[model samples]
Target: MGDELTEETGHEARAPAEGEADRRPGRRALLVGGAAAALGTVLLAREELSHLWWRLPGVDHAREDGAVDYRGAQWIAASSANLRRADRPDDYRIDRVVVHVTQGSYRSAVNVFQDSSHRAAAHYVVRRDGHVAQMIRELDVAFHAGNRQYNERSVGIEHEGFVEKASSFTDAMYASSARLTAAICARYGMPVDRTHVIGHAEVPGADHTDPGRHWDWDRYMKLVRRARTALA
Candidate 1:
């Protein structure tokens, strides 16, 4: 009877061992499923990150014209670039192009405009490499000139330079500014003449002085003329 009891006990233990072996495949399947889910999540995150860089909020599509959708641009704000519709009742007609120099690095100029304490702004900032950054919209006035009247009618473009001793603007910068100004003129139906395009120094006021003695007036005019012809 004791021998019989010992055999029964061994059989009971073997039954449980078989049951545990049967669970191994299920455990491996669960681990593989978890790894696949993790991989899928990583792929989804990568796609979302790419979209974040290129797409802007509120701008669903790009315009046919070269002009970027200001509403979607990351740098623009509702209070700064997005002037209320009531503020701009009339269509913006860009009559004059005012040239200025940042008197510092391109990065510095962007920082100043972003800083509220700096109390300075411009419609466009042209870099030494001829890269252009449009800070404010054409319709909204920038606080470039102390005089509001001039600011309202003129589009200010700040170049990277200190013009007192600098004899010439960078070739790239000059080319970019000329091209941009020509585009603005074409869009607004403005003439590309000296009267319409003036240096910051030429602005009527006692305080305004920029794109100073160092800037080459004749060379700049030639570039502007060339750009106008190309645009036309």
Candidate 2:
């Protein structure tokens, strides 16, 4: 009887151990599955947040003529001063469209514009990915050109292209800049000719050379013409 009782106790212990071993894989699988699910949720949330932050306003809908309103596009404001005039001229009379290339990243460009110590700014900064950032209002004079006289009459647009020969301006950036230039010209009654659209290098005694040699001026001009035609 003693031997039989001992054998029964051993069987009971072995049964529980076998059962626990069988459940181990399922428990581990559940833990791994839960971790995977959590990671996916986190990634999805991050994507949604990024979309919300970068999405531009008034560019999604189509008009009656099937044309979208690009002029109403808003950008992240980075200006430190309210240099804009409360009462602007009824007829927008911009004389020149000045093109530049930020020698840094889009974030860095905005930071420099915002930083008082830098004492540098531009009206607009166009990203390589085709994102537009407004540092100053159109009516306000941005401290872009060292010459205050030129700054007063010019609309400065800084493109995202590195000074290195390896870095090239993307198609999206060219397209976006053309569209932006067209909108500005239309609003301000500025001509789309080369005389009106000048590069930073062309500015007299400008002392800055940007939108470097890698930028395709011919392709950019073609897009600009297309945009002008569209506006017309």
lDDT of 2 by residue, 177-222 (tens): 9999888877778877889888888888888776667777778778
Clashing residue pairs in candidate 2 are none
Q: For each candidate, what TM-score against the reference?
A: 0.63, 0.63
Task: Report per-prediction Cα RMSD to one decimal.
Answer: 21.0, 20.5
lDDT of 1 by residue, 1-232 (tens): 2333334455333233544655434777999999999999999898545544434565333333335422222343223432212112133345888999888888888888877666668878888888787776675667786666677677888898787657337888887788888887776777888899888788777376788877877878788789889877
Best by TM-score: 2
Give model 2 RMSD, 1 decimal.
Answer: 20.5
- Taken over the whole model, the C-alpha lDDT of each candidate is 0.69, 0.70
Model 2 TM-score, all chains together: 0.63
* C-alpha lDDT (0 to 100) for residue 173 of candidate 1: 83
